[model samples]
Target: MIFSRERPFLLVGAGKMGGAMLSGWMAQGIDAAAIVVQDPAPSPEMAALLSRHGIRHVTEVPQGLTAGVVLLAIKPQLMDVVLPGLKPAVGDETLVLSVAAGTPVARFEAAFGPVPIVRAMPNTPAMVGRGITALFPTTRVSAAQRDTVDRLLSAIGTVEWLDSEAQIDLVTAVSGSGPAYVFLLAECLAEAGRKAGLPADLAARLAEATVSGAGELMHRSSEPPATLRRNVTSPNGTTAAALTVLMAEDGLQPLMDAAVAAAARRARELAG
Candidate 1:
């Protein structure tokens, strides 16, 4: 379902995630002429992409240009300030898809007067076209519109449709913020390696490469992550020795559980 140009796609923000999504869309064969990017100051990379593709770019919502899809990819904190300027561009048939975390569909309905809205949470991995997005559409969104949104979001990566909006917060806590968690793991691994007498640069490279390689392997394999983990562990092996500590009653599991809970709590708080 390549987005057609009945009404142009009015992108609200063209920062990293948005830019990456646009890049993916272009790669997936969406017509660049059917897109309008509204960003006051796109990053250099994004700017270059826009220029290269001849995609329309505006500092603010353009007057008289109708939008088929108003994809809001800005930060949640900026929603209020950005919402008012967007109303004029949205049409009755437009689908409002938001990738901003903690922003509920009600918030958009309040501003747009009962439009079809979707609240989604996509991680930074979208920048590499490997991200997964969780989408929850309002009742106003029809099945056809949902399919359109799915195709659009699929440009970034896989799309998961949620049964309830409440689950968005949990998804946000996990995959939405999961990249940072993985990065921290890499950082910690590097530091531990350095402490164990490896050179800093070599340790950092080893940790990063290992994490990315393992992730790639997992991506290509049909095996479950737990199965892969078990395959890596052997009787009295070095990996098993480390797993013993990590699997302890008060180890990574509890810490991760607490961390995810706190993130979900904060996401709920941010919704208000």
Candidate 2:
């Protein structure tokens, strides 16, 4: 499918992730009339917001409603039930993008019959337009279609394209499930602060701000993360003291390696 100002986009689900994409598109001044949202039970906030924007919302896929780009944002487990119903709305010319985890490109190809399929693994931060999405497209997808998907995802956050679908499983283990790891860090840091005698609220606030600020710095800085980390560490200082333990043979390195391995295993299992 060729994406142009004239092409209408269909978002098959309007949950948190889907809503975020719609909001990003609207915020970027994309035409509201060019988008169609389909959800059986869209949130009241979403319903009201879509209504205010004058965008189309349907509880069911309307007959003969052809969309140039169709976003499959529904749960992977529900793809079988959803795709069959959506087949009519999806034309041969439609470019299908699936954000559902573990549902491979072959599944969509089987259902949609060789329609250009781009599978993406987007993190939770996309809800705030600061996420990163890793995309993997089938060989059948045209360069134009790939560019269109890339642009659409880039609106929400950074987009990274992988040369192989095998990398998507690793992407799922990293960025797809990475947010929770960062949140866990915040949790641990907050607990440690409280143990060091800070008030619970202050500890939580400090932890949140520190993590967020560090992440923003890493994003804006030209230096690699290791450089930023080394810059903060001073010989015999508190930061170094902490690093001594964290960088130990059985510390964060081994722990993270094990964690990512487990996550990758789970992703593979889910795909199977």
Candidate 3:
């Protein structure tokens, strides 16, 4: 739903992810003049975009500008300082959506006085408008408000609604931190190729293209990832030879499992 002037969209933090989302929204016909961006240091790209789109980018939360949906995309550690300024504009009917990692709904409620809140975890991919956000809305959020939040978040990428807030930590470990895992895989592949006598640039390009191409194929295919793997692996083939080590008991699976568990634990800890 396009926001009306009666309830403008107030974006807190116009950094990469937030800037990407705003770009998407503008592409989809949202009025930039009706939106306000609060960011201390917007990138050059973001500053140019705000100027082009006629959106307001202010360092302080503007007085008397009511927000229909106040989307918080700031750092979790800075919430105490950042959120207090936002309190005055939060009306009874206003909805709050947070994309700050490891922040819980209770913290928002305590700060904002029982406003409807939706906590979300979005990855860095949102900067490219290909991210997936996992959301958990509190009971105070109505169906209509949820739909609005969905439409707003859809600007970045797909949105997955969760049944419980506890699952957000797992989501944080998985999708929230998943990009780094994929990036590391590509880095390792490139290094291995270089060690195997490929030129540095060639090895890096090959690894990057292979990983990205495989990811694109997986996205377009209806078959499961496991099935895709099997299709690529022939009995006694080079792919199968590589898979043998990868599928071993003490291989990538166990390592990834431990990594995810540790991430989830840290996510929960950060919530405190």
Cand. 2 Cα-lDDT: 0.87
Q: Estimate each model's TM-score.
A: 0.97, 0.95, 0.97
Q: How well is each residue in 185-219 modelled by candidate 2, as lDDT tens digits?
A: 99999999999999999999999999999999998
Arranged by TM-score with the best first, the candidates are 3, 1, 2
The regions of model 1 sitting more than 4 angstroms off are: 1-6
Task: Please provide, for model 1 over 33-52, each residue's C-alpha lDDT reduced to its tens digit, 9 standing for 90 to 100.
Answer: 89999999999999999999
Give the clashing pairs for model 1: none
Q: Rank the candidates by lDDT, best first.
A: 1, 3, 2
Task: State each candidate's clash count.
Answer: 0, 0, 0
Per-candidate local distance difference test: 0.90, 0.87, 0.89
Candidate 3, 223-259: lDDT as tens digits: 9999999999999999999999999999899999999
User: For residue 198, what is the lDDT in candidate 3?
Assistant: 100
For candidate 2, what is the TM-score? 0.95
